[model samples]
Target: MRIIIGSKNPTKWKAVQDVFDTYQVDTLNAPSRVSSQPFSDEETREGAINRALQCAESTPGAIGIGLEGGVMYIKDQLYLCNWGALVTEDENIYTASGARIVLPIDIAEQLKAGSELGDIMDQYTRKEEVRENEGAIGIFTNDSISRRNMFVHVVKLLRGQWEYWINK
Candidate 1:
């Protein structure tokens, strides 16, 4: 089966590749069609769904996957959240959320000030393209869970759901 991924990011590709290892995987630059920095679970999930739908639509007969990272508020504290979506050619959609970590107060403040997490993380870690690598999760978790692994978990959830549905 051909698996179509919605982003060109290597991290997201690697996550999918890890799970769907034997499949013929392909990627296209599908837009999230949401805020560059999604501020809530709803928006983040929407972005993921949009990407998955677009990819599935673009390729008539394949499974499309989208992975998105965002932040959300819980009791006035900001937490980093990730979401993923899988859309089958038959239009079956499966969505799942991954692990989240509470952001430091300083980072939360910056997010409230309208700074995207990636940019803030880059500045915080003094690294370039952190989002495409270990990401804020890695920085916060001390590499206990890299960003790619986070997305890998999400992909596994999505793929597992799809498998269950198809087998049913």
Candidate 2:
């Protein structure tokens, strides 16, 4: 099987690759068609689904995967959120989200001021392409968990769902 990731980001592609290591993997630059920094869980999931569906339609006979990271407000506290989607050849779409961490007020302010999390993190850490590396999660957790690993977890969930559906 061939899996086409909706984004060219290596981190996201690696996450999917980790989960579906046996499959042939490819990456494409699929548009999310949403705000660069999604502010709500619904919008974040929407972006993932959009990317997955678009890529799946564009590449027949291949599964399309999408990964998106965003921020959300839950109970008045801002938190970082991540979502993933998988589009199968049969038009079945599976989605799952990862754990969220509360964001510091300063980071929230920067994001609110129109700075993307990746860019803000890049400037704050003085490193380029933080999103493609350890990511904000790695920085927050001191390298315990990375952005790629977070997506890996979400992809595992999606695969589990797909397995259950196929078996049933």
Candidate 3:
């Protein structure tokens, strides 16, 4: 199962590698750089889809992945997280479920103000170093886990039983 990821982000790509790297596959990158933009009208979903499509179209590999997050209202509170997508060489689509956690007050404001959540945190956060330590999975800030661990976890959830997915 040779896979090609659309992103060059070490943290995010490492997550994909952790799960699929062990398989009988060769993962490659797309010819062009992939975007972190949202795919749908909603930021998160839109970002995920855009990444996946752009990645697949641009890359020369069997699989391309895009993951992103946007705020969705659950009750009165809003949460943000990963909205993921998987695409195969034959254009088969597989999706990952999004799991969101609530945003801290100050952080939420910046995101609502149209700044990318990651960028805002990279500039301002409780611990200035947290921006460097954490990646999309959001482990370093609150959890004892490292960015590596979060990537592995993401890979697990996104890895599919590709053995049976014969490209028609």
Please state the error at residue 80 of candidate 3 in Å.
2.3
Residue 62 CA displacement from its true place in model 3, Å: 1.8
TM values, all candidates:
0.98, 0.97, 0.71
Considering summed lDDT, which 10 consecutive residues are worst modelled in model 1? 53-62
Give the per-residue Cα lDDT of candidate 1 at 73: 90
| Candidates, ranked, lDDT | 1, 2, 3
- Per residue, candidate 2 scores C-alpha lDDT tens digits across 75-139 of 87889999999999888999999979988898999998999999999998999999999999999
Which model is ahead, 1 or 2, in terms of TM-score?
A: 1
Best model number under TM-score: 1
lDDT of 1 at 113: 91
lDDT of 1 at 161: 97
For candidate 1, report its TM-score: 0.98
Off by over 4 Å in 1: none
Candidate 1's C-alpha lDDT?
Answer: 0.94
* lDDT by residue for model 1 (55-156), tens: 899888999998999999999889999999999999999999999989999999998898999999999999999999999999999999999999999999
List the candidate 3 regions with Cα displacement exceeding 4 Å. 23-43, 59-61, 126-132, 136-141, 145-148, 161-168
Off by over 4 Å in 2: none
